[model samples]
Target: SPRFIALCPTTLSSSSSSGAVDEEEQRLRSDLRERFLRTLLLMTDKQVEFNMHEKVRVRARFGASDIDVLNFQVSGLETPLGVQKEALLRCQDVISCSFEL
Candidate 1:
């Protein structure tokens, strides 16, 4: 999967000659991916503010992301021009996103 590959380091260190280190690295990557997915789940249906490139910022109801995490589906997106009832934001363009607990 591209997502899994993207989450991993492209190269291994010289010390990674041991299988144990490879296993540990894989475990850590799995843990990180799980935590990220959990955070996204917690953000579901909540109001989220997304800070994007070019200093663009928008607020919208958080929706689901694709399996690849390449895009986000949102509702009531308030852009500088006007409010968009629904929109898909590319993850590459987004710098960060946040929501209140």
Candidate 2:
């Protein structure tokens, strides 16, 4: 197997104008980040896989490394406006998403 490399690795946390981080979201982000950083940060170009027509998680390919999603978070950009609608729609399509370790 090829050794994974961190092209731009750094620690990150969430902050809002109100400076409050939702615990659940924080946990989810933390979990995703932990999974991502433990391996390699697959480039952002990796395919966006639809696991159940509703659940969408980026899949890291050959050139990509497993990366904590937070590692890819923008410094100041906020969440998407329609993100909630999309998430709700996804949830309706898939009961849950499971990742392979």
Candidate 3:
């Protein structure tokens, strides 16, 4: 993952002394990534509200996200103008998103 690589540049380089520490860090990062992916999977097809930049908020049915989690695909996206049948939201514009159980 590009984000992972950017966050942990040391993982890409060779370091013998901290190899054990690197392995542990990699394991923890893997677990976190797995959990995040599972959460996204659970959010699929659910009604979600996305809070975006400039105090913009919209609701939609969650579809899927790109592999890098840089964008979200949604259906029935409600906006100020009208409801969009389908839309893709940039993750950078979104501050947070939520859905009820």
Q: 1-101 in candidate 3: lDDT tens per residue?
A: 76867887786674566888888988998999899999999999999999999999999999999978799999999999999999999999999999998
| All candidates in order of lDDT, best leading | 3, 1, 2
The prediction achieving the highest TM-score against the true structure is 3
lDDT of 1 by residue, 1-101 (tens): 65545655542443456877777777887898899999999999999999999999899999999978899999999998999999999999999999999
lDDT of 2 by residue, 1-101 (tens): 12222421211223342234455655776797677565444323332332344334432222322222212221121123323212212223433333333
- Candidate 1 has its poorest 10 consecutive residues by lDDT at 7-16
Q: Give per-model CA RMSD.
A: 2.7, 16.1, 1.9
lDDT of 2: 0.34
Greater-lDDT candidate between 1 and 2: 1
lDDT of 3 at 12: 68
